[model samples]
Target: MKGRCDKKAHLTGYKAGDKLWVTDPTAAAGETLQWTKQPVPEYRADHPSSPPFLRYGHTATEYAGAAYIFGGRNEASVCNRLYRYDPYVDKWSRIAHGGMIPNARDGHAATRHGHCLYVHGGYDNDMEEFSRDLFRYDFREGVWHACALCDRWEGMHRDFHALSTVGDKLYLFGGKSDELEPYYSNRPVYDNHLYVYDPAAERWDRREAKGEAPGGRRSHSAFVIDGKLYTFGGLNCLAGEHYNTVHRYDPAANRWRLLRPHGRPPPVRRRAVACVHNGKAYIFGGTSPLIGSPMPAKSPAEEEDEPPLVDHSDLHVLEILHMAWAACGLPVPRHDGLETRPLLPRPTVGRRRPPARPKVRREVDHLRRSQSIFVRQRYGAQRPPLSDRHQ
Candidate 1:
């Protein structure tokens, strides 16, 4: 795709895998979007389906023409099942991978580096503890393994953070940490620091990033496009506010810029899944801050922490070429606790037929030609499996 993926945030459409949508070039001709979800086949016994409960902190990444879903929580408990969805065949399969499968958990970040899926840092609901360990799942060979980190966790453990791959290094940012504080509080501790992991070296370096940095946030979304890293919409534990601001990072130069786009931006949301397709940034269903909720109290005496959440199934698309927000003509989905973050890169596959509208494709193509795009930059070697050492 000529369009870059550096743009952040997403679109409205399928909230819980029901609707498939694209922007309405017509609306943006002065517009936003008109979207529709594709029909998913009925559930199968041999194969796994996108279950309603196992979505919290789970991720979906596109690889080798298929989208894979990894570890997340169901209502009753966390699961380790790995499911794959094929757009071309309209089918789902439960891939059986052998080796040291990571413990089932939620709020973990999964990223594709080479042929393996790297899962790190999540809350082990069963153990009632947080995990900062890294595990590797090799798709081609169907094996789960471990990585050689600097230490047990290599650093601290966090959940609801964002992980994006730039070349071979993985950039992990933000998330809620329980390690901080005086306890007896319901609120979370948020992290703003950035950590870069190099697979070849099997080490992580905490970079002291300079320039305009994004404030501490968790459950945010990020993607690297055109060699720049972009972030948007995360929860601020201290401020007690979900963010709407967008920031861009130039890794090579180590700088940050606040992105100011024109037109309507999506309302403040958290846990929204973000991805780059063609050239636009897609934001799917997420939890929006409850309107008319009481403000957080300033002290322990008048403590207030609960933020009522609203169901959000709308799909919103951002035109990366222009930094403007638009819409897709799909009804906002109605679902509570829709876990919609990508643990994998979202490809331009599985998208239903675009609405027969004029100027949409043409305009997008024009922008593609005019602006730079984010093409995949392969970095680092494939993570070695545990068997390598014994061999």
Candidate 2:
């Protein structure tokens, strides 16, 4: 939590290569103020046809007053386009092309290490074609370079893995080969092998861990906060099991530990993406099986009871500095310093009410209570909005 600030003097937006540790904004505001005064902020969504730049399986980072988004699928095709979004100008400009750049890919992993962008293995087209090619893009030099191709102990191409940057090394884990058909398997196959790539030495080496590691998963999310890699929620090997569990990896110890929380992680989903800002992990839109996937339903009753799912447009802030979670709806505004206003919370059923019924009129009081209950049941509860689900 060192080097973190939550006061008005330090309420800046998130940027890559910025401070990895920061104070929890909601927590720093005090528990009552966080929950009652500003439960969750509501941010309006952009138009549906905004742009194809920040589509599926891509990565984005903020730096130098601009947001850099690159490498994802556009429509049904793979894209290698690099785009820079200038908040000052409120516009997006194409900086690079997708022509023969990298394979048309999804399920790939990308992270900003130092001043360069590092991208690794993902599903090339279908889940069958996995890519192990590693590449890096340097904005300062305006160049791209191939780093390494991933391989298992038996020399097979692996994909659908989790990659993260911890300290100076890039780490990869829980991947399966292209030859492995995930659809037919009862559970996701576990590689249990850890691969580390060091950019300084340009060498690849395997690291061994001493504890129980997570099982093989595809489309899982990993982000570095306060020098630790926090991984959460993705598809597990089980037929219908989507992970809501959280795990933290300590690079120095080369170990994994489970994170316990009060409730399930939002809802079980996959292909989700996360980025760190001010020591908080902000998660945005991604593909979910509820929308597109090939799997049989377990039961009609279960399906009937399932809550409606959508491509999330909301942003979730995870405070790595204090180990907290808050649901946010507003787009990360392009403001910094003392000019930013902490977002106001979305209204809950408990807070808003109609005119109070007089105590002398017992019938009116009963009617009011019944009305409130009916409204609450019908609407359930209002959570924050998903303002940046992307076009």
Candidate 3:
């Protein structure tokens, strides 16, 4: 008797307990310090059990080695359904969660802590109001619970913000809100204030950080790595400006440092998803205004004249440990003695703004000067002068 054989048995997706390796195709031979896209299971158009539909403003959190995706909106309507993606099996299953599910929302923020996932702040189109309510989903119980706060957080209601978990606490960062100013106005207001929520205490505290923070933004991505928090790529809807800048926040010192990582970075976008794994941060998928075209206008008449936005499908990665090493005055490995190159500032667009260097560019220049002074103090005797070395 002959045994049955399978030709595609070796391609069983990723192994359950095996380590994953990411390679950079653009890097020179033997150089792996660059951004590269990782392979994902393809979903055919005819496949019945495909991944979630294309949407923006959804929240994805990793739990139990699987990614849980919740509420987001498409062109037609918003969603409150929950879906889970299993990488090992390369499958997406819609989770039928129990208990009181929150209303359909988009622009919300979610983060995992312990066995529960915390979700907060989104806009509900049906109600036409932004949510300040916080909800928690217990993975063990498979239920959702509404978390009640001790104090009334009237001003904390917002959407397009970022929430990150760091050392038993959740940090909420900049987002666009209409509740603060202009009296129930349609225009969104952007802010850079940092707020911290302690699950143990069940309360929130506002953090006044030192150094220049990133500009007020919405729809940005935030990640907590090694006790520090980093934010990237958000938009200022009020000014019609998008950002590809990166900022690092040290909770121990309560300071913010704008990071100008060496090499090319991602384009200006918002509503991107970012995650940190094994000393690297991976960012994927966001939308940006078309180059040389006007942004979405505020007025109804002008809004119709704006061009369609460009949706990104690219992946970029940042070397977090190398950046930290550079911050600590250590030379980057495998690059000889070459210094990290500065990121060129992006040109401002849209019709509402005058031609001028934005505040972020000025701050980056200031940080560069400060870093130069620090290098002089620490390694002036061992190394040649900056001008001499460059020449």
Candidate maximizing lDDT: 3
Q: Tell me how many clashing residue pairs each candidate has.
A: 34, 9, 0
- Best by TM-score, which number? 1
Per-residue lDDT of 72-120 in model 1, one digit per residue for the tens?
6433345667877665565667887788877676678878889988888
The estimated TM-scores of all candidates read: 0.72, 0.60, 0.67
lDDT of 3 by residue, 193-281 (tens): 78888988788888889997998888788887789999989877556678989899998999999998887788788766665655666
Instruction: Give each model's whole-structure lDDT.
Output: 0.59, 0.50, 0.60
Alpha-carbon RMSD to native, per candidate: 15.9, 17.7, 17.9
Backbone clash pairs for candidate 2 read: 4-22, 39-345, 40-345, 40-346, 187-237, 188-237, 313-386, 313-387, 314-386
lDDT string for model 2 (1-391, tens) is: 0011123111211121121112234554433112111111221223331333324555555446555666554333445556665544445566753223555555566666788778787654432234677888787777778886555454224455666778898888765542232111111244656788899988788877757676666666777777877777766433455665668878888897787654224556555556555566655434344534433434311221222233333346666656666765333332122112433322222222223221111112456445544554564422111111111
Clashes of 3: 0
Model 3 segments more than 4 A misplaced: 1-54, 150-154, 180-184, 294-308, 324-391
Q: Model 3, 264: alpha-carbon shift in Å?
A: 2.4
